[model samples]
Target chain A: MDEVLLRAVVPTVIGVLVRRGAPFAAAEDAVQDALVEAVRTWSAHPPRDPQGWLVTVAWRRYLDAVRAEDSRRRREERVEAEPAPAPAGHRDDTLQLYFLCAHPSLTPASAVALTLRAVGGLSTRQIARAYLVPEATMAQRISRAKRTVAGVRFDQPGDVRTVLRVLYLVFNEGYSGDVDLAAEAIRLARQLAARVDDPEAAGLLALMLLHHARRAARTRPDRVLVPLAEQDRGRWDTAQIAEGVGILQAALARDRLGEYQAQAAIAALHADARTVEETDWVQVVEWYDELVRLTDSPVARLNRAVALGEADGPRAGLAALAQLDPALPRHAAVAAHLHERDGDLATAARLYAEAARAASTVPERDHLTRQAARLHAALRA
Target chain B: MAKYLLLKHYRGAPAPVNDVPMDRWTPDEIDAHMRYMRDFAARLEASGEYVDGQALAPEGTFVRYDGEGRPPVTDGPFPETKDLIAGWMVIDVDSYDRAVELAGELSAAPGAGGAPIHEWLELRPVLAEQRTATE
Candidate 1:
């Protein structure tokens, strides 16, 4: 009956099956079957040891599938040569599962799908609903992903960066249908942080926590985006912000800075402020500098320009913005803000209109359009 | 039930009755227009008639393969006179009449002076999969 408890143990159960000589693909499918059965009967006959019960049922399912295949291929010896029982020490193979699901050979979409299923323990139906895709399409994607990583060996440590990237993608998917992907990302990140010694893992967890803490104030009920400066600070989750800042402080002390840590640090600063005017723009600008140096991503630089506008003056922000390609995403929006700050309402209105035209999402376009409309009204006044 | 596409255009469609450009509309008028559009979509979703809705950016390039090992040739971001698709909504309705009624409602979204835009929307039926005929 405890869905969270069920999902949390999924990867671990899958890991246990893999160690017991089941092929990775077959083990994942078998675990999914076990999960369905658990949902059906677990409430009426709750197992005293959920993990043990899942492993037993999943292993049996795996054996039945192999036996069916054996009969077809006439390879009875393979089924007979089952490996020795794995040690019952409860070694967490969840981290290895993350690496396999996020295998470099798979496409990003495939990796994300596989990770959500094999590592996050989400059902294909749930995943499909979250993504607004047909359940059959999601199943095909997960199947393809499993096949792609079937040959992958988990003997070596996975690039923590790859796993982090996959988790980040999941987080950005936000919420839809029955699943809150952001919360799921946070849960997976917490699990990964517990197993890995990487500060970046902790940093990623902190970053998700900080961003998620502001979810309530990020939009209006009508789905219009509320700008960061305009968001109701009282709506921000104080406890989550505190947790994020504490994790970020610990990561910063390690002195091995990464992009996620730097991003988290910026988020921590924003959360630190009680109001827009109280925000430490100087520190925010500094973090943006670190972010740009670490990633050299245009997005970071564009954001840095906004911070600079607030920290120094609108001129400084506009000057920084001038260096980047005008074609960059959100470039026009940034330019509009800087121009508006510089008292050039005409230019700001024009840029806002352009930004609205180019916006990729409905909410973003609506937000930008409103901005342009506001400025145009002011100009007419 | 059959699926139909209700298409809106940035250009190439006949000029609407309320022909004022969106940028020229008052802020309140613009907000009203957006609200009308959202409410329409929400109603369709509530009735289980909505499949999908999306708005596209005005700019798009036309690209085609040039030759083996050569970069694809590309054309202009289309001119204003060209028939540019603004966006579309896909709906599964019980009949063609229902699709037309929904499209009509959508085209009546508020525009300048809080009046209906009465914009032209092209309603097209989506071809369904071939059916297996029963004996």
Candidate 2:
């Protein structure tokens, strides 16, 4: 079968197996087997009904495994006792899979893995590679997560916020493994937005598209981390930016303000600017204010301070920064940036060094270290 | 998804018995060794198989909390310890077999003289709770 058709059908097949009370792990295996068969068989002869074909093949695979482990009599009984086809026109069961995958019981990593497995129809190896973990370790984490949420009712709806959070995490990982998680996240988010009609999902999808659109300009061939203000605007993906803006406009039309919508608004403002100096920092700061109300996260507040600095002045940004906790991750980096903008090169250089020490990733540390080196060299000159 | 910790041990391995010191190796050999490690990391990144990898300082200071009214006591590099960890990589993989496969690849990371070490790197599965919830 074509890859796109398979991707669309696999989740529906998984939903059927899950509703049949197949354990998440077994259902996943069965679906994978069916997908393999589909790839092998369907390439030469496309199925008349792809979803039905997948469901039938997957059910048989599941029963084959179950039969192998059970007594002959029990196996025969199960095979003969297959439940009636799910009633037509019933609510789609895939949403429950989304909820179960996002079940609060599972940790974020587990939740993301489960979502990719069950909803995205990705294999354990594929998921493991995407997350840069060993296939075995990722497999165990996914299985454990499935067991944790095995009790979730099929009909129960899951928290939209939780599901969105998982998708956000997936998008933020940026492309690392064999797959582009950012694209996968967008695909999943589109599925979710269609299912739930949630504006925040749209908002988040828009935000991701907007950010991804700028990815080309975010780094140079030498692998340096270019801050947004310094990024080459010409390289930004205008198509993605336009799509994001369109989605944000629709979401904003709903008038139900959300954290994601506010953030998307800010991203949209940035995308609209022809040059960094032309950025509407005043409107961006206003949206940040809305975002701070929606999600009282310190990171949001810290970001708002940067916008405030751009809209108002460096002193105003510094004053806003003073109110936040000193130990927040990247606090020193933000301070360094603000001080550097304020022309306190000495303090900026010192904080840059401090930030470099606290940087969590090699690229981030390298960037900060470069800042410190540059400033220190300038001082010597 | 099982989690495996690939631990690098700085102990219980035969010391290099070659009469020539590492410094005597051709510059190209040393460059090859560094390239091997860099390539290994790049491969892991491409495969989306790396979780977290770090090189640890050989020297470690030990600190212990004291009784209720006292400050914690700090101790030294603990010369008595036999199995010191040089570094480690935590990988989340799909099965024990895949973990072994990756570990086998990691074991081939270049050592002195640009040769694959193939040394024993202990593989331990991290307990689930210890894993950070965030990616």
Candidate 3:
């Protein structure tokens, strides 16, 4: 049985229940129970109509839970007391599910957890494992998040940016455990893009694709990071890059110029190049400028400095970097690179070592350490 | 997800509650300990938490560059001063608490008299890739 296909229908089934006046948590729980049953029994009894089957099963399960809470009522009254079942409905509710799960009231982590379960149709255990939290902790977090959102009305639309932010967080989680959350984020983004005409959704999808395309070459065996300039570009997934570029082109045509589109455009510029030397640094610098203005983010400015260094020269890059706080993360690494380019190998080596000490990830630390080692070896020779 | 290293040390960590040397254990007790460890790893794999693990050989060599034109220099294996890392099991999990829980479980592997060892396994967080271009 195509579990993904079954999972894809989950939001709509829950939406049907919620529209029928069922509490969001109770309806979500019912749908999840139905999903578990589906996974177990679908191989033996595959339904001809998956959505219809799920809606029936989930609605029935919701009733069963309610009835079991107090079996004092006659079966006829139980059926009558229940809200009339809403129409089985089209796939349109998936977008609503996204908005509900990404509701502004929920914390980002809680929203992400809720979305992965209610919309992404992931098991609590799977989500917990993906995040590295113990199953019990994740369960409490998810249940708490659900309780918070239980009262929210689904009719009023939510801010699309909030939804995008949640999806972005999911994508940024990248890969760990068994699930590729990046891929899951892309899947949800694609679903959102299909339902909404918002260019930013396309922008987000484009950005995710562009980054995901280079995932294979991001690290070497044993998870040692290979910096962009040194990565073997042959490993990049061409198909994903093409798709991202296509989506980006359409978003750019809208002329909205959101932060995501700008980031995607920068990524596209890198992807279009045959090698690091071939990258259009000038155009990338322009996009970074656009991104900096849109978000006014320190992170964007930091990236802009790097691009500026490439577009202008190492000295110009250093000049741009000088405008920012030296305490910013990776500032030393960037400084080290620009210094090495400007013929200050001794200083570069020192900064590289410093950067290595502050490195956030194992691979990044190893990469910076290797850079320092090479520079030190050069000095020794 | 956060990745962590669970380091089993031959020395240096705080003394375990079960402080008896492995050599003191019966052969069957040692076998049971190994089996428990293997099963622990297997369970982590089935749960999608395992990344990798390895056991170090007892001996190791330290080398250094002498000069550009000279052969590299080698030093004596300092078994006395050195803190021997017996092995490491890497796991990717959601929270620091979860990592601690796993470490606690690993330390419970059977030891002398086939009772829980309570060995002090060092739990260290692994650094992660940058999510943004700037930070």
Measured by DockQ, the strongest candidate is 3
Error at A152, model 1, angstroms:
1.0
lDDT of 2 by residue, A166-204 (tens): 999888767755777888888888888878878998998
Prediction 1 global C-alpha lDDT: 0.86
Model 2 error, position A380 (Å): 2.0
CAPRI grade of model 1: incorrect
Q: Estimate each model's TM-score.
A: 0.75, 0.75, 0.75
DockQ of each: 0.02, 0.06, 0.09
Residues forming the 10-long window of minimal summed lDDT in candidate 3 chain A: A71-80
Worst 10 residues of 2 chain A by lDDT: A81-90
Give the poorly placed runs of model 1, Cα more than 4 Å off. A75-88, B1-135
Residue by residue across B2-120, what tens digits does model 2's lDDT show? 56789877774444333234377788877886677678766655444467788888799889999999999998887878878888887755567888998888777565666776677
lDDT of 1 by residue, B30-125 (tens): 999999989998787645456788999989999999989999999988585478899999886657788999999999999999999999999987
In order, candidate lDDTs are 0.86, 0.79, 0.86
Task: Determine which window of 10 residues in candidate 3 chain B has minimal summed lDDT.
Answer: B126-135
